[model samples]
Target: MSVDDGAVAIIGWDPSLVRETVARGLRPVLVRDVPAHLRGTSIPLPEETEEIVVEDITDVGDVWAGLTRHFGERLHQELRGIVTFDEFAVSTVAALTSLMNLPGSRLERAVLMRDKHLQKQAVLAAGVPAAASRLVVPGSERIRTPFPGPCVVKPVAGGGTAHTEMVRTEAEYEALLNKLALSATSPFVVEDLVDVAQEWIVDGVMQDGVVVFSSVGRYAAPCLSYTTDAEPLHIYRVDGTGEDERCAEARAFAGKALQALGYTDGVFHLELLLDRSSDTFFFGEVAARVGGCLIQEAVLLKHDFSLAGGAVDVALGRPVQSTSETTDRCVATTSLHLPRGTVVRLPNSGRFAAADDIHEVRVAVLLGVNDHPEVRATTNWQGLALVSAASLAELDARMAAVRGEFIEQSLVAPTFGTGVQQRAFLADYEDAWRRLL
Candidate 1:
């Protein structure tokens, strides 16, 4: 059965993507999970949608059955493309799309895309500039690589910054492994820690075997430089000029990565380093979906670009309206990491929030505020702010003012809890379960 180009099936739910998918002149079928806890907040489904609710969309079995049962007989014929916003579910969505013979990433390639170890292997095979890495499995003798001064430890299939650590010594490396106590099957990936003066992200749109458009973002501080000090949680990781030399280099790197990863259509968020020491660009990491936090919002506020929308357009084989080469405006996003513990009153934001460039203020953990917050991963942040300006200097000045006044009002020391204790607890539970089973 030949599929029509009028309807697109989204295997996951993202409000922005749903809205943009509809705007692109296509019918949307939202395959979403109706979680018991989140039922209180009714997500406004598009007026035109074929929504598929499941117990858990992240599970492959549930997603497969949901798409099959909900789409019914017309799935293969009417569904034009299969799309998803969930990072972990990307492979599952692609595989299901392939089974239905829809237009999307190939099942085999999609599976490899999610595996960080293999992704780097393919990228390196293509002569791409990426962090040198090795896969470590317990009791495996193939661990033959000289360790760098500071390296990053990553679980092979880690979804986000979870289980990721910056190991400064060999003891720390071994300790990280013992700390994880991963299931026998799970292995880990270790990469040379990137020496970065500033971290930048290339959020690009890929379609028709080419990168149509890309945006560059600069971080005020490295995302993974975890510290327990009373540092401001929300540093300005802002978007930069699209035509800058670094951005150009990043775009070239991204093209190579896409080809290597077999990504034909979708939004690709590529994180690479502008090596502070070497004055060179090196690949940090890559994902086949939109980047979390500021990347998406910055694009919209500055260039009216939607990474999620661009992705849908790519899936639908629609033309992309990528941003211009040079950007006259500057945009910055500050993530406020709230203190941990019970609920408390929030600081006064009446002054800084009133600024004109301060367009968006989002509070994720307002119900429960903490004075001494526990930092686990990137998800530990409490709130975020979006600011834009006409120039970099003005942007910095405004950001400094806001930081001094509103962003730093809550003086709480953050606690670093990278699941070390939690891992030990889980290891005990698993031991008990293993014996019982």
Candidate 2:
């Protein structure tokens, strides 16, 4: 079948991605939630979109019914593949692809990636090194950790470190459980925390169970640290050919882990924890979609290719060109977060954008004077920036400068009453500015 003969169903609303897919010769069929698509964004759909079907993207049965009702008999002939950029819709897209007999990640593989326990079991069974973990069901008898020392507890099926915590003693564990119980996010996974010196993220594209393109990035700080710490999260790309030992090792490990998980096609985001003392790497987790934040933009800037476009190609069963040839330039993506308080001033984005190294400046939240920022236990950022430099040291300096400037110009006043929570917030707010200098 030719690329122009059938359409690919994209399960989220991204106008720019739709335009990119259209430019590659495949028609796009959008699938979105009725309430979210109508209320979420003000941007209109692209003219290249063939058709859009609205349903609860979280409900696989509703989405299946909606797709069937819209296409009827043409579902088989018109639909080439099903894909999604949203983490919540990964399993839904996988199920639909299986039902439609289209090309995409299998349902079982998707399930393994979605559930933390299952993912660890699959990888360990295949002789991959990973942290030992066990499942925790709500209302069940309290289970002790298999390994001693500090352990991490988090939702069995979630991302972005929301509600993830590290507990050392029984009192802390009990407190965490009570906190989680009130929130109703249960079925947690408790794993022994690795003595990690640094964390690395591997973003790549796979075709027919083989890796085609891969890149390695070193995180300045672990993503989990951002939830309580004041440091900005930065990921600087490792530049060089496959001969670079660290980059090669990370890429190889990522490929082996993805293969063990039964991921055959599409883009993948994998994380690995490094123990510098022993020169060992531990499997953190993997996702079936593009890495969140500015990962896609970083890949495009360094590799001169589009991961979004690659996902569209893989979904449509088109041959993917290898991204082995890179610009050999240093690029990094930084996410800046604000303390929980009322906004007194906003940062000057134009000043950051004027720098030669700065490629893009994105402000997610627009807070005016006296507006309280949204509070959450996650790595949600208020703004993001993309920068490129000639060397790693230069990249770090530029990132530090940008981060320092943003915090200095933006002022947030504490609105919460005097309490432990308010005191902690104020401490983080002050420390964030102090560390920048």
Candidate 3:
């Protein structure tokens, strides 16, 4: 398992992750799509990268050809591991891992992590508590409603909440179908919308079928609220204390859910819906990669460890030093959003970065006057902030200050499209903001 001269084929280009891999004494072979790599920020790849396998990382044939051409018959020996931070490449990585006879999660388990319907079925069969879901093929005869009342409809294999919708009535469901314009081959899932009081995210690392590390964080508002209702998305790590029963419950549930899905090794990002009235936790979904947004950053601040580094170690079959520890320290992350509009002004990043409680601020979008920007439906953000506090009360206060003083005051934009009137849109925004508060 020593990685002195071993090379790990990373399926995406992330400079920080590449640096971590290099720091671990393993050479990094970047398998990236040229077009996608160009679309990202202009950060240079780490100089320590051993080789670049340029191809469509999501295509098995292309990746196989590229890797074989580069490594020739030494694919199994030279390449010690294959890994990816990209969600879309999870299944591809798994297939490549097996093809190369490398240590990694099985392809079947990776597929379960990718497809929501299959994931739910597997977990539920293993006695995990999860929302009941039914898969709907576009051309199939309509089946009877599996669950009554409000439900969530989403693509079987989707991310970032794109094309996800909440349907409360038959009319809404029909309208949603027309809106999505799904073809005969498209498949979707319909699941009961649990009355969720709080949504929790559990990020962890696994080694040889056992969870070696885990951390729980509660969202300020449900993820659906951000896209559907225009509420800001925020999450804070739960201070692992005995006072909060949900924190302990979430950690236990995440282990069970990962085991149910047959995810033996690698990292996992799992979501759980808390039904406060019933005191129950339901499996939301699980991904075979790190959670999106600033989750990795937040985890590092809270636990003093690197998930990216850990993923590399596990992939290379090197023993990972567990950094799991309980603490009262608080860390939080929030995504900054702006209403659909033409940007008139950009935010003041300096002010945010100066705040004592704010650890990091990232502005992703650059804008100028009169340029129309597409409305955000996914978790994409104009900016992201990571903040830390001494206590929950302090965290709340600091977050409120960020929302009201920094974020709300910084952006200036006017409604751009002809779809909704500016006045009505303002009213909706206000309502959503109030609900978030």
Candidate 4:
């Protein structure tokens, strides 16, 4: 089924990965415009990929122009597919595929997937286990809609867990709104909390209508751990042997949920909340793309296949298959939490890199000579460590080994004037400029 001659246009090409996740028979063409920092810096690119730089490639017309300009000489050979890593560009890629008669997703299904409320309603209507939610605008007359204790609020069209809040009290609800800083007309989703005990992520690749690859991984602690400062984020792939019960149950349940949500092809990342008492395994949301963080690496280590590459293969009508049925290995992705001012000393990761079990180590915060970076929500993690082992205990030990190497350092403030002077100045200047405008 592979398109042999035509090339596929990869919208929003990720610069971090030097090569395409999937090996393609068709030529790889990169159409990218973001990650503005790497403008002058060199990031790897595949040797054969046709690079076309354009502004706002997410715009449908811009995508068309970029693709046509690159492939116009070979009109007889049309594009095989259009794919995007940028979550917001999902609809635009689908639309362009349909317009150009390429093998890809339906525009309507992609749009429904992006819309939070509509997707929830669709799944609920299909009798899929889902949480109750309502759409609320920033300054709507119904802004005071009664959400009982343990409710949640989020953007109708947001990703990366930005501004997501759990409202268990009136005070918390008000504080969440203030933190969000929503405009008078912006849209949001307020939902009945599912009394979540634990949360997990299921990532897989689908070809045609069948799930070609699937795996389940659970967070070390509930994501709500971030509700307080003590908790950091940790996601661990579930270790499954032959006839693993939890993996089997999760796969069957997730497959059904994907069908109910009208997911037909490509890769999917589903976030599910487990509340065993009420027997509720309701999925909070689903994305028609690969999972973020160390998931791609985990998938590669445990299953020996690139989840991102498989999605591209499916998009181009190529065969996408899993090499193994069950895996005993587990991979852990831990996001570290630290004091928020200027970072004094980062963990020396050479020891971790030398360890066989440890897969990767990352320090997210950039250090400056005299200033600290602005601290956002839980999204602004201090660092990360990916370790692998056969059991939870061993995995935990390996992760601890990495953390143990770090020296305990604090973000310090100056004695007089604003402690972090440079950051404070930038923040104040931005505020004043906004007001001036």
- Per-prediction tally of clashes: 2, 0, 0, 1
**TM-score of every model?**
0.80, 0.86, 0.86, 0.83
The deviation in Å at residue 131 for candidate 1 is 2.5
Worst 10 contiguous positions by lDDT, candidate 1: 409-418
Residues 1-437 of candidate 4: C-alpha lDDT, one tens digit per residue: 34356677777756422255325556677777655424533345656567777667768988777776777867436566778767888888889878877766778888766777877898888887888878776555656555566787878877766666667887887666655555433578888878777787888888777898887888776665554446567787774634267667777778877788777877888888888687557867888777666777777777777777777777777788667544577677877655444454466666668878888876665553333223234455667778888777888877775665643533433323464776685576578679999
Regions more than 4 Å wrong, model 2: 1-5, 40-45, 50-55, 142-148, 241-243, 344-352, 368-378, 407-414, 417-437
Off by over 4 Å in 1: 1-7, 34-45, 138-149, 182-185, 226-243, 323-327, 345-355, 369-375, 400-437
Candidate 2 structure quality by residue, lDDT tens digits, 1-437: 22476677888776556766777776777777777655565456556676555667768887777778877898888887778888888898888888877778878888887888888988999998998888775445675343345888888988878777777887887767666666654588988878788999899888899888887888887766766676677887775633388888898898889988998988888999997677778899998888877888898888887778778888777888775457777889998666666776778788887888998877666574343223234347788889998888888888888877777788776665467766877788789889998
Backbone clash pairs for candidate 2 read: none
Please list all clashing residue pairs in model 4, or write none if there are none.
Answer: 22-309
**What digit string (tens of lDDT, one per residue) describes model 1 on residues 119-169?**
888888888777877887754556534456589877777665766778889
Instruction: State in Å the error of residue 367, model 3.
Output: 2.7
lDDT of 3 by residue, 1-437 (tens): 23476688888766657877888877788877888656765456666675555667888888888888878888777888888988889999999888777888889889998999999999899999888888775434574344456898888888777667777887887666555555434588889888888899899889899888888888888777766656677888885533377778888999889888889988888999988678799999999888877898888888877888878888888887786555466789877765556565566777788877798777766665443223345456777788888787787777667766645655454656555566765777689789999
At residue 90, candidate 3 shows an lDDT of 91
Instruction: List lDDT for all candidates, in order.
Output: 0.69, 0.78, 0.78, 0.70
lDDT of 4 at 263: 76
Q: Give the Cα-based TM-score of candidate 3 against the true structure.
A: 0.86
Off-target runs (Cα >4 Å) in candidate 4 are 1-5, 15-18, 34-43, 73-78, 142-144, 178-185, 241-243, 344-351, 369-378, 406-437
